[model samples]
Target: MKAQLELLSKYSGTAIEEIEVLFKDNPRLQSASVLGVNIFEELKTQINKSQVLKELIVYINDNYSVGDKLAPEREVAEILGYERSTIREYYPNLKLFGYLDIQHGKSTLFKRSFEHQIIELVKL
Candidate 1:
């Protein structure tokens, strides 16, 4: 973990002190690392997930109209070049953000324009 942090510090052009300050500011992040999680990798994964989520939202907004039934998760995943599980994982987030209305058995429907919801998404 020390090595990973050092690599992060070097590549990110952030000093060790600044990294320590960030850890101090976010206790959960610090505790996660203490519990043996690779903090750098975890952070990288989260950043990547956020980027993918944004891409997915943009794709949906540009390609489909409100109330349109979306393709199945597998088909959407194939079209987006992501794993089916990845698309599935973001379904709840889409619903919560008012981008989609997902029903258990029925097809998912595009719920609203992404313009307003995108502001909230960036905070996530």
Candidate 2:
């Protein structure tokens, strides 16, 4: 752990004292360290991007119909409490699954009913 901290300090330019303080402050980080896992990597893998996609599907199903125009990415991000980039990241997935039609310089449109796609998303 000392070696790991020293390497992290060397690469990140963060003092060992500051890194120790961060570990002391965040229980999750402390736990990850104790388990010999990289917390940053764990955090990246643990972000439920599919869950967010499922949520967007449900939101579209509940609020919009086929051919109906959807809000811009920024507005949808605000409504969903996610970064616009995150929402945009999943737009292609939605399009591939036949739920949405995303076009450059145009509002996204509901391409089809996503009620059935919810089950598919759960399997992902």
Candidate 3:
């Protein structure tokens, strides 16, 4: 199912953070994620559960300029190659993993620390 942007929440320049990031892997998670750089963690992002996910991350970094309002889900899906539902499924897990603010209904405001960490994760 496709997503809409009418439900977006206002941004308040908040820098959200999550302190609970587990190195353990779940069966439900993509294999690439589970097979990430296990030896030198703490700064890993493991973004390759699927190509769609990898695209989603890069799409966010490329499109959402700071101070630019969040794009609607429809636009996001086009760039991420994911159905809205799929992206939603990833959000809660990502939030727990350290994605700062999930704003504009279907968008994410990546945290610097999380960005640094997840960037490493995706690269792996």
Candidate 4:
């Protein structure tokens, strides 16, 4: 467990500190140090390229779990390293991708699709 955190920490480098600050709120992540760091670090990279949503798709791929509640667009924005409005702006398209099922300010997901050809819509 510690070793996994260490490897994940390696991926964060300068970003570890930021993730640590966010970690305080998510105690379940106490031992999994690297996961949050990697998420934020990778998110920054993705947002810069306008591929933030795709990055989230990849994230759900790495952490496969259904019933994920993507709410508080602020948090989703934080994960994507973008503004909350950006998530709203592209939300319909996200729904079209089948990764997101949004309604009434709540976002539910079918993460399995992200496991394969998730963002292949652009290619098609």
Candidate 5:
């Protein structure tokens, strides 16, 4: 467990002390660390540009409804055939880009405005 935390700390560029606190205090941070690492590694692999983004958009369109709750990362991963670690990598991006809004300890809410923006960006 210590080693995993250490790796997560290093991967996230966070101090070990801070990560320890997060491990105990905030489960989200732990999930974030693993997700961050997956995203970093995925970017490194040089897969086709926009592929993940496009796929994510499609997934969002297919699964989410405005004002509806999103499933947990584990369930989404099962549905998408992706690893939970990999699926999490996109969650924050969706939020950051205004595609989704997360409510702590509650399901994420879809933001419909992002649908068009994501489609436009993916086209380029």
Candidate 6:
């Protein structure tokens, strides 16, 4: 976890202290389940309650100006202590909401426009 936080800190210019609010805030990110299996609903619950998950979203969103690239789901899962399959299951929602895009042979990209929507959602 320490190493992952360090990696996240490296990716984002803001230190952990500066971005603590992002982690502390009650961020509720959700979407309709594409698979119709309630997986997203389950994962959203976890993400909403987990500071590490919220930090991952915020760190990527906050660091987007530096570059939109994101660490893959597998790496993020390792950091957040979730299964890669769980991360993979939740990815469709992220993509559906435009928070992330997966490119072949390239790192995922975080979308700032969608991130703005997320910020607005959090404000509500």
The residue pairs that clash in candidate 6, if any, are none
Poorest 10 consecutive residues by lDDT, candidate 5: 41-50
Backbone clash pairs for candidate 3 read: 45-121, 46-121
Best by lDDT: 1
Candidate 4 lDDT over residue span 3-120, tens digit each: 5445555764635455556555775775555554555455345435556556655555555466666546677678768887876676665565455677774455643354232345
lDDT (10s digit) by residue, model 1, range 1-124: 4664575476568887777778867766755554433443443354356876766776787789998999999998998899999889988877865669998999999997765435345345
Tens-place lDDT per residue, model 5, 54-95, is: 666667777667777777879878877888888777777667
TM-score for candidate 5, residues paired by index: 0.51
Q: Would you list the clashing residue pairs of candidate 5?
A: none
Q: Predict model 4's lDDT versus the native.
A: 0.56
Off by over 4 Å in 6: 1-56, 62-67, 113-124
Predicted structure 3, TM vs. truth: 0.45
TM-score of each: 0.54, 0.54, 0.45, 0.44, 0.51, 0.43
- Steric clashes per prediction: 0, 0, 2, 0, 0, 0
Candidate 1 global CA lDDT score: 0.71
Error of 4 at 41 (Å): 28
Model 3: lDDT to the true structure: 0.46
Sort by TM-score, best first: 1, 2, 5, 3, 4, 6
The segments of candidate 2 whose C-alpha lies over 4 angstroms from its true place after superposition are: 1-49, 117-124
Number of backbone clashes in candidate 5: 0
Arrange candidates by lDDT, descending. 1, 2, 5, 4, 6, 3
Residue 56, model 5: Cα distance from true site in angstroms? 2.0
Between candidates 1 and 4, which one is better according to lDDT?
Answer: 1
